[model samples]
Target: MGVRLRTAMLAAALLVAGFALRAPFDQLRRYLIARCNDPVRLPRLAEESRVRFQPGARDCAARVAEMLPAALARIEQEQGRPFANPPTVAVYVSYEDYARAGGLGDASVAAVARSGYVLLSPTLCGDESERLAGVLAHELSHSHIFGWRRSWFAARPPSWFTEGLAVMVSGGGGAEGVDEAMAVRAMARGWAITIEDTGLWRDFGAIGFAAEPPPEIFGGDRFAGRQRLAYREAQMFVAWLRRIDPQGFARLLNRVENNESFKDSFVKIYGAGSSRRWSEFLAGVSR
Candidate 1:
């Protein structure tokens, strides 16, 4: 009888130990999933980090899935080949969260390819739903064009070209016009930022070449002044390219994606060095 009692107690103790070990793991798994789906926590992880989903994120995901095929079709029409992979998009509703994630709502951001996602805020949704679709279409074009490459490449294309192409592809004509008018006025006032100075968009913190101290424009109420200028000038340059040779612009973009040297591609399409053509183009616009 004592032996039977000992056997029963040993079995009970083992069962209890097994559950004790599994309990923590079960709790940890739940915690991990909760964090993954937490809209607020995920955005705070890192700058330019991709959060796969947020609470109430399914709506934006569904909207993107619905709109992306058509946008891809347009891109294929221009490039003559399908994109390498479909992009991953993340949508957030909080402006604070959006800024924390290193994003601006005035434009959608496309990280070069590895797990590319879109960050959307309520401000971008606005009254019309189609506007959101347009924004997604624009950012997705960047994803498609860049093809999942990170910013580590030494010979990457410039911000002006990438951003200009995105604006051109997303059909952002009105914004381009508004920026051009503003730029013309700013230039007249002797306040125009130089292109060399504007190249700051390539870096994370310092997005322009001005002497002003780095501003916390991402989290604050205002837009980053230099970033705003870069986007505007990029749009105008692309719009100019479209006006000059629509088909050539399309071919040039395709060539860019194919890893063609920028100078070679420019000479082939525009019949001269890009630097020369860009200077002439800027001068014409300024006049």
Candidate 2:
């Protein structure tokens, strides 16, 4: 019995050590830094950009912060515009603790842009550096939209265009965890939501969204399915748009920044029946 107990204890000790080793390196480094530094506020800076936070599950701060400059460069390169001042990236430790950190609305949000700060939660996004970087870039896109808009009164573009652009630019777009074939198959079944404004429709048939969104897209029996399909459609559509119109995409983005409505900007490039063109492209590719 004594020998068995010793063996069990040794195994448990090793297991604990293994778990500790699996902890993210940045989290550990920040912990050590916080021990000697101030815990009330910890700031990590890269290329004069900043990530402000207190210690918690938010250890990916330094890596994400470092990614900002390069991400911004890519975003600016793609959009044909730049910002005079980049928004500060703020890292909140976790989703559940977001309110404790002074966030509003649902903590379930992965990230958000508000005022002078772009808030990111590692807990919501997992501690993976790449995922966090994507989240940062996406939120930065939101900031870029506002910054380049250059007008406080300009109505923002629809969520689909804005969020889709963010996803593609961050390299996180493309089928999201859903397979392209599956999406195409869903389209073939004719159960796909129609491409319309960002608000409506619950299905897609390889073609893009279509008109007259339901008064409410939520609360239906198919709400979850619809919402999921909506996001996939948005990302895929933006990617398709960029793919087809490359240089013209820059013009479209500029028009949006110049406060042109998404409808006008798209029509200006693809001409009338652009939505129909999306369907024709889908038909050619899916078959």
Candidate 3:
């Protein structure tokens, strides 16, 4: 074979290897750091439930333990189903350890639902217990979907639906910085992110915030400003659907859990296309 062809083949192989190894690499790093953690068990959580933090972070851990049951209950109550297999919760005592986990791009995130874990930052756990509970519920909502689908190969839901549902079911956990009234006003003025169809790589975080939120929203925190606005907008959309047709919202969750096409499921449950539903939601919020 030509030298050039051999080099091309080698590059392709390396690319594939990198893609396969990235997840395991990050998990291993997180596991190593967790070795020093002190575990806090909650019998009310799922079978594999693990909540742990560094030795000196007991106060934060205790607060998490106290709020955990209520958090899990809130998601189950709102979604009408229990977690198939809840993700383990890992608490970091500081931002340094949280950033070393490697998957998330932004360090401002209070907590994130990973493939099989929820990593919490110190800032989140240090906040008021109520806020911690809300954030915990929001992350668990993602974990519920992760487990119910059973595998990463299952149908990928759109970011709008996933994050929107999380914020809605968690009672505005991720959208705390952006209120419903403000989000509605922004949507009415045509400053909203486009609701796109589900695709493998269509995460909102990856896409970045397209909607221009007001300059004064989160003060100097651009990340929080844009992120919370998108989250609030999506939450409003989902909340509207839930209020308009409770049965349909329930069916939507069922279909989503079963790895069904989201767009098709919306149409089947709502008796109209997703586009129509979007228009209806916008009209109601605007009025």
Candidate 4:
């Protein structure tokens, strides 16, 4: 064949391949955009959410309030108890202040004062107000589960379990879909990391906090990877437990919150004492 003809054929083939790839790419883009734009789905609260928005916080507290009842109901049903008190949600726009307060990303931070106030960052509030409500509902679950104890030691929820439970309760149980997808992707890529090694749950004293620089204290690549893994694994494990035994999982969470040992919790809930069950569950899902 002539060189000109050959080059033209090659270009034509490349164009066709590009066109073929476009459909999936577009689909993915649309999916992500939709997810981003969707309202934050939060679990309903027993009481109405009193959201106080900071400047430029995008006033959506009323919308968030409307969505809280359903989310709270789910948690109440799962735990078989009402929240100890009404929740006060505050939305902020300052990343610096949030970091100073020891927050990650745009997160719902529960107070240690037992006041039931949750600090939420606008960036993490999601595209619509509903999405923010969902995030708040998740945070509220942590608050309810832990009471006034802000210490990680107090919660002692396995990284996966706490996060998974939060995801499960948030958005009336639909947020689990996103949680599962992120988790399965992490598991398939062998990126899942144990939370113990990361020391993310460790409590830092005032002196210790002052001694370490902010950058040194907060952002480590290894730690970040592990944190991501923890969130993913927690979601996956929660989903697995729900699938295996919904009632048992709920009972197990309540038991654990009441200071049950991990082994005891597992035994009571799953009728097994070995971590092997978890490993098997992961392996099965990864397949």
Q: Which candidate number has the best TM-score?
A: 3
- Top candidate, metric lDDT: 3
The total of clashing pairs for model 4 equals 16
Q: Write the per-residue lDDT of candidate 4 for residues 1-287, one digit (tens) a residue.
A: 99999999999999999998886675456445434422223322334435555555544455556666776777677656777665666555554444333232223332211235565655555433445655667777776776633444543555456655675666432142235566566556665534221122333100011122223322454343344345556656667777888788767766766766656677767877535566778689778
> Per-residue lDDT of 1-287 in model 3, one digit per residue for the tens?
99999999999999999988887786565655544432333222322236766656666767777777788888888888888876577777667667655245345778877656777777876664457877888899988876788655666878888888999988888878689888777777778766765744323343234466667756898777778888888887888888889988999988898888888888788888766788778777677
Compose the digit string of candidate 2's lDDT tens values, residues 1-287: 69999999999999998876654554445344433433235455443446676475345666666677898898787667786466777676655444333233346456666555676755534643445766677778777876766665555566667766776787763224444565565556553445443221111112234442343533342433454455555567778888887988888888888877767667778875446666775686568
Sorting all predicted structures by lDDT, with the top scorer first, yields 3, 2, 1, 4
Can you give the lDDT of residue 113 in candidate 1? 23
**TM-scores vs. true structure, each candidate:** 0.60, 0.66, 0.78, 0.59
lDDT of each: 0.55, 0.60, 0.73, 0.53
Clashing pairs in 3: none
In model 3, which runs have C-alpha deviations exceeding 4 angstroms?
Answer: 1-49, 127-130, 199-211, 214-217
Which regions of candidate 1 deviate over 4 angstroms? 1-52, 78-80, 93-114, 119-131, 148-154, 173-179, 190-226
Clash totals in order = 2, 12, 0, 16
lDDT of 3 at 127: 61
